[model samples]
Target: MPAVTVANPLALPRVPEPNPLTGTERPVVSVTTAPKGFEGEGFPVRRAFAGVDLRALDPFVHMDQMGEVEYAPGEPKGTPWHPHRGFETVTYMIDGEMAHSDSHGGGGLIGGGDTQWMTAGSGILHIETPPEHLVASGGLFHGIQLWVNLPRARKFAVPRYQDITSDRVALLSSADGGALVRVIAGEVGGHAGPGSTYTPITLVHATLAPGATLTLPWRPDFNALVYALGGAGTAGAERRPLRAGQLAVYGPGGALTVAADPKQDSRTTALDVFILGGEPIREPVAMYGPFVMNSRTELAQAFEDYQAGRLGSIPAAHAEVRAATPDAD
Candidate 1:
């Protein structure tokens, strides 16, 4: 075997303290609903997922709220086949069922507590459609779709997928009922997630009961954001009641402390939240529709290749693209 050497772990970056956001502290940006495409239809929303644009997050690009919602019988709920390049999409399902199919030949139904990580390298086409049960029963379908940019070196590496079931993800509990931390990726309290990630990331799904508090250690080098799934809570010194469809951006600090309202006596009123923080790419991004590339020329070439069917080889259902020609890359 050739000599092997391990690469050094990426250095964690330092983040600054967040300015207190009082009633007067203006939000950096407001979260909004995504617009429908020319097709006149987009992701179905019986309950809307509030989306935050990635402009403030830099290379992070776009994020969509595919949260819990109800649908009536025979209602249409699905996203048609779409193409993407030079990026990745992470889908976390909280409730209901979703069926995913892609040109790469991979298809599966993700039920509650499932996560799908897809790397849309070079180019790939895929679709996420709602299951019949979800359409007929009109129950809650909660989830989030996060878009992460590919580094220039890996933009055309080849598409890959990592499907992680809820049971397989790591769950860490606080001894005093302070909090429950679900490790979706990276590490928390020495616990690591099973998801395959290209970048350094720490994704955690957390829940806090009434009057409970949880403190999380932080690495200054990472960019952090929190999405409130339901109920209300406060982070750091700021006491804010967050609801579903709301997102909180945290400034870099050594640690983060969260507390649930003790005034509420019902356990059902506890707060549900997702804490996702990752190392910042700190790079330029070029995005056009579903595709994200490092430069406009590379993006144009990707479009041309997809249009010519050069990237249409479906070797296997859910098959991963291992390698491709330079032109395709």
Candidate 2:
């Protein structure tokens, strides 16, 4: 839970409390526990979007809560080089280090509290793994990887990358200074985070002290979802029980609420949650392994292109073969 923190939340800007009379508080639609799964090179993950309807997720396609596990030396793992298209991959490191390299010359080391945003617009090839030193020493590795769906209009946009550090994120506090909210993208309470997105969305990481409640003003149009990273809490005005690895989807409203339990487990002193939402794409979704397109024909074309070495090649620095990203739309 070392994503980001302040010793004194009271000194930060506070989120205005929603008006009880005028603001409509979003109600919890459903709470689904994420099923555990292994991803990449056999690393454990919690499938955050499991059991949730894709229409509810809209602009979002997939999400994974990567290990809260401590890896012993030589146990660290990551994905091999892979191809992606028609979407963006957002990797947020919460308590570990990850090294990223791509054929487009977009590569960097993301430490705790940092984020790597890669748009596989038309297509791209990339690999993500634990840093050499981290792998050798064995350490804590925890993070989130989210796949955001690109609208049909932008599916062929040029691939781009952005590195967003924790310091660049917008920080705010609850009116009572009981919660610390980190806005990683989009606007919240007039505060905008540094991460740029093609979709109209908001990403927030909030931590609440025991017995604290945070009420946030949300856009009526953007769908809302809250996923608990750790600790216990209640979501929405009706107070649906929520805990780690659980995701709560909300109904339409002008605001939402999350309250931390008065008592927490010995491992965690507070409640941590990841809140995200976006304007629904509302288009037919045709997705397959590694590609998200609007039609099966397009998906087949993507696979053919990838097999023909059109997506991209492993950077020469990492592999013997160096190929430029193909100019295709």
Tens-place lDDT digits, model 1, residues 61-118: 6665664456557654666556778888888887777888877688888777788999
lDDT of 2: 0.89
Candidate 2 segments exceeding 4 Å error = 19-22, 320-329
Q: Per-residue lDDT tens digits of candidate 2, residues 1-329?
A: 56689999999999987666646999999999999988877889999999999999999989999989999999998887788999998999889999988878888999999999999999998888798899899999999999999999999999999999888989999999999999999988789989899999999999999999999988889999999999999998798999999999999998999999999999988999999999999988898778899999999899898888898777678895332232211
Deviation from native of the Cα of residue 126 in model 2, angstroms: 0.1
Superposition error at 233 for model 2 (Å): 0.9
Best by lDDT: 2
Best by TM-score: 2
Steric clashes per prediction: 15, 0
